[model samples]
Target: MRNQLAISSLMGLALLAQTPIGQAASNLVFCAEGSPAGFDIAQYTSGTDNDAAEPIYNRLTEFEAGGTAVVPALATRWEVSPDGLTYTFHLREGVKFHSNKAFTPSRNFNADDVLFTFNRMLDKAHPFRVAYPTEFPYFTSMGLDQNIKSVEKRDPLTVVFTLNKVDAAFIQNIAMNFASILSAEYAEQLLASGTVRDINMQPIGTGPFVFQRYQKDAQIRYKGNKDFWAPERVKIDQLIFSINTDASVRIQKLRKNECLVTLNPRPADLPALKADKQLQVIEQAGFNLGYITYNVRKKPLDNLQVRQALDMAVDKKAIVDAVYQGAGQLATNGMPPTQWSYDDSIKDAPYNPDKARQMLRDAGVKEGTELTLWAMPVQRPYNPNAKLMAEMLQSDWAKVGIKARIVSYEWGEYLKRSKNGEHDISLIGWTGDNGDPDNWLGTLYSCASIGGNNYSMWCDEKYDALIKAAVASSDRSQRSELYKQAQHYLKQQVPITPIAHSTVNQPLRASVQGFRVSPFGRNNFSGVSLAE
Candidate 1:
């Protein structure tokens, strides 16, 4: 049945490709790496899921295309109080929300939509939350719920956010994908029809594209939002996500003209891709980190010395050479070197198997200690080939008397199990959501993120305090010092082994234009179009 479905899907794609370049010139088919978990960006944290939501939704603030600088979107402009506790946003009037067969928005994007969007995540007793229970992973991981004292609507066109404390990254935090706005009018319509859950499954937002249909693990289709406030940016008439998990398959689709753009191309394929006259490869220093998270909650790994010994055993350079193939730099800190406040003075532990073995002995760890190494199933910009990287680490650990058993599940299951502390060690990585150090240090290592993005399940009060202090201070130099201290503290704790900071490689047909590789590792097709 699966084989038949694959063939049928391929056949449909071939038909799509047959639509003459003149007739289908405005249509874009992107060979995405995987299926989105769902359309509700707030409910998930993965880039794959965010890619699905990018066109369908717009945040009050948005990171500029190809850069991390925050700019206005739904909200035309905003004001920050002198005390840094209150934020007032003036909404852009006449912004129309996308409509589906189920619900049509009677009102424009307003303060009510902002309240409904955030309140559903913040208030436990919110009507939408009560009808369809869910957790906003990114929102909670970043401590937005705790930091935000209240969200109040000043008027139909203005909204106010009062923070419990000064948040230095407040603007950048809300500009992330998880903060994509939803239409309150549409939500109310769904609630009245007793189908509130459809708000996520059938999304309605005020972005450049309108949601049309989604065939799980196959394809998703959208039409350019004719009523979009920024209609000039909606260059393409149609956008399609062709879900293809295999890197090789996506490359093949790109070569065959079945897909105009493809993501995370295998590192070995870069040279040939760049040499190809028919293709254009875009490379950028990724604001990302690939790391091996030691589940500190697990028995042997709970020991700091054991974690340090494991970190010493693996050769990050070898993995980078073999896996990334010259497309990455060795990462020595929890956050990437490109990020501000990154301490270059911090050094990684030397790769010495003998020293690692002795350290394990000193820590009272037995020779041949067994551990399960969970590898990712999908390709991310930070880690091109996680399975191969896992095997390399397994071999490196074996030399230091550690019996590493490499295991993997489907992409979604792998993340869920690892986040639930099911693995002794897991291969995971992150692309910075916003250009903030807190987005990395806070979201991944902070105490509040323990059960969510913090797969290490490790937290220390002093480390948490440092990050918290960094977030509370608006002063750059002070925040940098605090973040540096936190990095030093992380080096001593060794909860995770920093692997590499990879360069993002995006390959598309030469005919494709206006597609810029996002620093945040998301694909946005707003102003992208195809040449005849």
Candidate 2:
């Protein structure tokens, strides 16, 4: 029998064969809580729902995911101009969609759908236009509509994008599943109606699955698109995504054969899972990092000394071991080891309670000063017990004469409070959108960027300049150098302390095959199935 592969090891899948039988014969059922935050690919704003969105929608291009190759999805091939400013995509011909009630044999896949998708992203008049908050900085970091001068449909199978400035990573950005193509017909319908209810509940795409029904938190289902371009390779007939966020409920279901797969397993559940001879527990590092964020615009945190004091005081390794049960690795500085941009030269803050005490004293953090820390009621991304983690920090900081209060809010309310920059400190984490460093640094730290994700209000002009220079450069060597400099500066500033680089923990039944993990914490559900 072949050795069981770690989720991360699946990234280098050169030997995996394509099979017609696999796509038609297999059926896999899984579970996740709630539909993705939203579903319009253009206005599809949140990171959580790609599990359902990715297989239903396809991008012009695809990143090799865990590996280094740039694989083609919708676009058969593409070319970056010599200056790296223009990208022309040569679309594949004869690609048809799964038959739908609205359209049969799906109209020929063409540039018009591609044109509508990009234009919708840049259209300020659209209702969903407000979905992309100006506070999320990477919109400009990737230089979206601002850098693109025009997108012309060269032919039915060709589309060209002209940029205001050279963007070396423009092609990679397109690989973002968020850029999934939408039918011009469907887009027009949406434009006329001004509501996403129909599309979100029932989406259309050129990928492996066709939407069947969405029962809100109860379940979401999709039928295999046998006529899909890669039908033979997909090997799955149906998908059932169930909602089971409660760890105990999920684990019980997994053991009873109620679920074929599960994610974000609790630490206590690991031993029992591992001991279960009938089931398999696969472990790998996740791409997420747990960290504390301070409102730089707010008092106390505005002072670098207080931020550094909090950074120095906390015991990251202890938290990792006790809170996470050694499931995750420790973070050094701000970079994850899995990322190409991580600089080994950058080091984590030493855990010294005394140093934290001295720094707090220097900042005049009085004994009675109550610092409130914010977190969501349910654990997310890293440190499954974010509320508990906050409480731990509160106790630790108290030893250093800082009175910290831990607060929990619902996910939506927590997000709202953080965005308004009202918290003394908030516990947060991020999963990298792609391999690029800008997803973390540039998107979160750029100066007062519109739609900026950097809610901490941390800004450094020099750091911003380096990120700009890196993106603007088509030269690989020069761009890398610029990124290195930006990382170096980021370490010195100590905006958010680096937590551990996360490992993907996706436990599947032995019958489930072709399961793989993407850096973005998404599943390529098209290739997954129950081995018959």
Candidate 3:
């Protein structure tokens, strides 16, 4: 029951030594929830706690976690066609496997590897999609297979991707690690049997870390891939990702030096961890929105005036202060400020009780119409103080003569119900998928993606048209203009109120040199090493 809020002054660079503490192994112990639960690179989807697949899988291009646009990972360099419809990538050479096998006669990564990964995503029998059905279901049926004009191997060193049309976001799509290149030779063995768990379990990728072993609900081990292309930069010799679900337990491990890095540390643990001279905290603002969504497709919420009434009734600033404890800021626009397209002209939801009462009365929800409010478990911050928000709204709406009931569910199941639009109102948080404004707006508001993550089920044809145009147009300036209009429309409608943009409260042991938390939520350890 302690709420600690203090920032440590470890702002600049610190020296690292080759040797580590305690174990001769020199492993960086990190505590987080084991997400994706399994080792299939293709199956790894976002959410949950663990960044399990990153070490074993190498994407064609990857954003440097905390850094900007895609930097070269597996592919050494690439070129675009004169028409912008095709891309040719020249692969890096001499990357050996964890199996200690010799580099194939090609001496470079090949087109066949990329082809296998894309085709495998379309394969219905694959278990990779099973790990994250909601998110990847669209990937399987993304219509990329039929639309891909062709995929040709120019030679061992080059691969060509020809699209049916000039899809500007194609590069961004490949940057998604889901399009990670697989070993054609190994994948062939799995395809012959029409199953791939065995090969996926033991992945072979050209990354800094090589998979060692995994113990379910306990740990996953990896040894450094010394022969990696960027060997000089990837200093860490090994990484041991420990699965510690309890937030308090994770913090204690950081204090005891049992773990080098602790993610999602409770806000209360910050001051104590800062007091421990051997520890530090890096607080970065993120583009994540934590809001209470009213499923407008369902009964009470189906009423527009009622939606407006609730929108006007809730005090977002108070919630941001009391619940989030000033760890985050109030959101005025649908898109988070981190996104480039967030328009500054949009207004925040004003707390107007008189307006809320009039709107509810106009909606015909007489004196005591009871509504059910849904929430998630209190473990992680999908509104740990959601009951407080619900109670506040219940009292606010009562001034307008409406009654409210509260309900809660486990995180995963709660997400499922919210997706189905089954609840009147539910609390949810959205982290940016690819650091793009389109990622936030398109996923939540695009009519095409309804019932997926667009839990509110709010629809507007004009808004949908503008979003579609923005996605298709390749011009950055024009696209930005169109999205600005789209955001304005969303603000006027208010299907979901823009709540608080929460900050990540991360704690790191002082020995954990070069450890930093990324807004993107990727566990980047490229610069990480132990203090001497």
C-alpha lDDT values of all predictions: 0.90, 0.69, 0.67
Q: Tens digits of per-residue lDDT for model 2 on 280-364?
A: 8777677777777777777778888888888888888777777687677887755576767567787767788898888877887
lDDT of 2: 0.69
Best by TM-score: 1
**Candidate 2 Cα errors over 4 Å, as ranges:** 1-26, 33-35, 44-46, 65-68, 97-106, 126-141, 194-197, 379-381, 420-422, 448-452
| Candidate 1 runs further than 4 Å off | 1-12, 19-23
The TM-score between candidate 1 and the true structure equals 0.97
Best by lDDT: 1
Which structure is stronger by TM-score: 1 or 2? 1
- Tens digit of per-residue lDDT, candidate 1, span 133-243: 988878998899898999999999999999999999999999998999988888887888899888778998889999987777789889999998988898898788999
Q: What lDDT tens digits, residue by residue, belong to model 3 across residues 10-64?
A: 1100111123343433667777654344555444344552267767667777776
In order of appearance, the predictions have TM-scores of 0.97, 0.87, 0.82
Candidate 2, after superposition: displacement of residue 489 in Å? 1.7
Off by over 4 Å in 3: 1-25, 37-45, 97-109, 122-150, 194-204, 212-217, 366-372, 378-410, 420-422
Clashes of 2: 26
